[model samples]
Target chain A: MEIIKTSNLKKSYMLGNVEVKALNGVDTSIEQGEFVAIMGPSGCGKSTFLNLTGMLDTPTSGEIYLEGKDVTNMNSNMRAEYRLKYMGFVFQFFNLFNELTVMENVMFPMMLNKRSNYKERAKELLNLVGLGDRLNHLPSELSGGQQQRVTIARSLANDPKILLADEPTGNLDTASSIEIIELFRKLNQEQGQTIVMVTHSPEIGGMTDRIIHFRDGTIEH
Target chain B: MSSVFFYARKDAKKNWKMFVFVIMAIAISTANIIIINGFMDGLTDGFLEKTMDTSSGHINIYPNEQDKYIEGLGIKEKKLDGLDGVVAYSPRITAGGTLHYKEKFKTIKILALDPSKENEVTILLSKIDSGKTLAANDRDGILISYRLADDLKVKIGDEATIVFENGKIRVFKIRGILHTGLAMDTNTIIINFEDASEQLNLFNKASIILVKLQDGTLSGQYKNKISGELGIQKIKEWEQEIESVLSSFKTFRDISNFMNAIGLFTGAVSVGIVLYINILHRRRQIGILKAIGMKDSQVLFVYILQAVFLGIIGILIGDALGYAGTKYLEAHPFPDPTLGSLGPRFHLSLIYDASLVTMLIIILAAAIPALMASRTNIIKAIWGE
Candidate 1:
């Protein structure tokens, strides 16, 4: 079943007098349990597409359907609610709250949603990401790989249907990148988790169930 | 809800410098307000007490045709009947007089008081340092204030010649010395009304009638009744009688009050600016919150709660410091040149009522910035260049 879909999506930005079309006429869809990788060079609208699909950006002109519900023109508050319940994002920079402990960071989404059993669920997610021992430590005290693992734990806190990762291993070393890619494969294969990841590494891109290439906004499947 | 509070607490902890600045601003402003109000309250209370104790008997009576000082203005003794709230009435005759005590001469105000009635009007005579109260027939006996006695170099039982209106003179023995701790005391001498009536040749008439009202009764009604009975067109209330003194006190009080208000306003502004900057700096965090599905109202509430917390701390600090400062002032009073005339010391009561008002102001001031910070655009905050 298709869990994420976008139709004729276009995004433009005005840099002084010049209009830069970040995403132009892009149509794509990913299935419920698919581990998909979207590969592109720098400034090739890959991040823009991921942001739009993750509900972080509203396309200038397009339609987005999360689990068959059109969410193109939802208000900011409604969009936030939709994102909380159905979507999770992992930024290239990990983006863990620096002030919060690893356990607290993982529990952030559930806390915002007023979820019961936040502690148990956060503990479960931290253990799943192999950071159970580091739960009490702040993000600043953790290694880059450890922080990325915590970010992944936080993304799973809300039990989101589709995890959208924009360059999840972009800031990590070879071993951390392979470990993160293996985690994504495990989440998809063993747990039936659906993921849409954007990455530049061809080696990482080949490990996904399907690869979607982009040169200038539109996908080359 | 709890999440917002948790985050707000985290944020405040992370930014202790800003928090300290806000607290300090609020404390200083609150202290300024409290001290100024304390002084005003003390001065007004002191002035009013002294004036009531020394001169005006809380109420006064005079003829309807006589408004200002007149030669022969007195309420008839029979007119004292049918007055509901009258505690006592003292017939008084006031006239300028020149005194001679062994050639150390000085012009002074002479109050010809009915000795028995005068005791009911002023508490000063009862507090005499030496000698006894003059009898009704003691035409040769007089009471003088301690400061006046010192200036004239007169001792108890010493005779001083007093020259009244129309160059009429009478020699009276100073039987007592009164220290009322009021300006009027030093320049005033008290004599029996009988002697004054005989000397001034106004057998039954007096210059003024002092009426003491029953405690807790409204003097306004008594004043009207006295005016009606005496057919006096203008009877001055105690507040009006000391208008000059009251106005001066009021002016000083208002200036201090204005300064205190400004301090409070500035304290609020400081808190606001600090919180505003804090919000600006933490825009990314707010965006993260919004992205995590926190409602706009929720975000706004968190910041407001933080501001309220800061305001409370400020007000508490201010109240403590203000109270301590006022207490110190009370213990160590200012060297007042008017002390001899007014009193030895002036003290202020640190009122909780004013502090409550100041707390409300500081809280409101802090809350405004917090609310504004919360209501900012989350998307712009998150994704802006």
Candidate 2:
């Protein structure tokens, strides 16, 4: 079943009197539980597409349907609510709070929702990411791959239906990149976690269920 | 809200150096306010006590006719002798006189009291700094204030000649020195009642009556009680007679309030700069928080709570320091060259006022930066623009 759809999505901004079209007239859809990759060169608007789909930025003109519900015109607060309820995100920098311990960082999103059993759930998620023993350590004490794993654990804290990642392997070495990809593949195959990843590497794109390539702010084929 | 506090605590701990800097700034400002106000209150209290002891007493009875003596003092004394709140009373003859010590001449108020009965209503005898008090039989012994001695370069046992308004001159030995801390002491002299009556040509007549009341008795209440029997216009409470001193003290307090306002402004500006810098440093983190479904209000609340927490901790520490400093001053007062020891006094109302003012300044400091953070462009922040 189609879990996400966007019709004629466009995003534009003015940079000191020049209108820059970041995304223009894009149509796309993704099935539920599919591990999809979005690929393009620099300045081709792949990141813009991910931001719109993740509900982090507004589109200039479009309709976005998540599980058959049109959510294109939702206000910022409603978009935040939707993101909390159904979407999760991972970034290249692994933005874990440096001051908090590993467990506390994982527990942050759940803390916002005021969920019960957060301590136990956070520990459980840390263990699931194979970082249970490092729960008391700060993010500064972890390696790059370990920090990314912790970021993944944090993203899953609210039990979101879809996980969006932008350049997840961009900042990692080859070994860490492979480990992260394997982890994503395992989550998709075993738990049926829907994921849409933006990447520059063809090898990473080839591992996904399908690839959506883009150029000049629209789907290229 | 819980998440706001939780994140606020995290951020505070992470950036503790900056938090400590802001806290110390606020704490020092608050401490200055407390100390300055407390010291001023102590000075005012000391001045009032000295005025009551040396001149005004709790109540002063003046003559209805300024040029005449208080009529029927014997009858009034007999009526007031057994009054419940009237601890002691003394009749005094006050006359303006010119004093000559060597070549220096100054105008002075001559207060003549029966030394045997005057100690009951005034603290002059106990406050004698150099010589003994006048005895009942001592013919022409006089007590001059310390400030008067300093001005005339006279010492105890020196002979100072006084010329009364009636042009009668008498040379009297300075038997003692008085220091009462009130400004009136600087230009006043005390002489024996017999000598005053002989020199001023008064026959058994007194100019004013000083009355001491019992502890916890309000002088206004006693003044009201006696105003009807005596002439209403002639009865005056100590407060009524010390208007100039009271006004000067009020002016001092107003100046202190102005200094406190400056302290508060300085504290607020320092705190605001620190908070703004901290928000600037955490712009990306704030963006990430917004991206992950945190509302703008929630994000703003986190920074505000952080600032409030720092302010509260600072105020608690400052109050503790202020209390200890004032108590220490009370125990070991600062010794003045002329006025003996001076100490600081603590007023609880001042603490409440200072705390309220500090809290307001802190909130203003925190809110300006928090508003800026809330209105930050999320995309620009996330992309490090």
Q: Score each candidate by Cα lDDT.
A: 0.79, 0.85
In model 2, the Cα lDDT at residue A88 comes to 84
For residues B10-69, write the lDDT of model 1, one tens digit per residue: 777788777998888888877777777777776676777777776887666654463334
Q: Considering every candidate listed, which one attains the maximal TM-score? A: 2
lDDT accuracy of residue A6 in candidate 1: 92
| Candidate 2 C-alpha lDDT tens digits along B267-343 | 88878898899999989888888877888888889878887888898777777777888788878899985457788
User: Which regions in candidate 1 have their CA more than 4 angstroms from the true location?
Assistant: A215-221, B65-85, B94-111, B124-192, B195-203, B218-246, B339-372, B375-384
Error of 2 at B17 (Å): 3.7
Q: B316, model 2: CA deviation in Å?
A: 3.8
Instruction: Report the C-alpha lDDT of model 2 over A111-141, residue by residue, as the tens digit.
Output: 8888888999999989888899999999999
- What's model 2's interface RMSD, roughly to a tenth of an angstrom? 1.1
| TM-score list, all predictions | 0.82, 0.88
| Per-prediction fnat | 0.49, 0.55
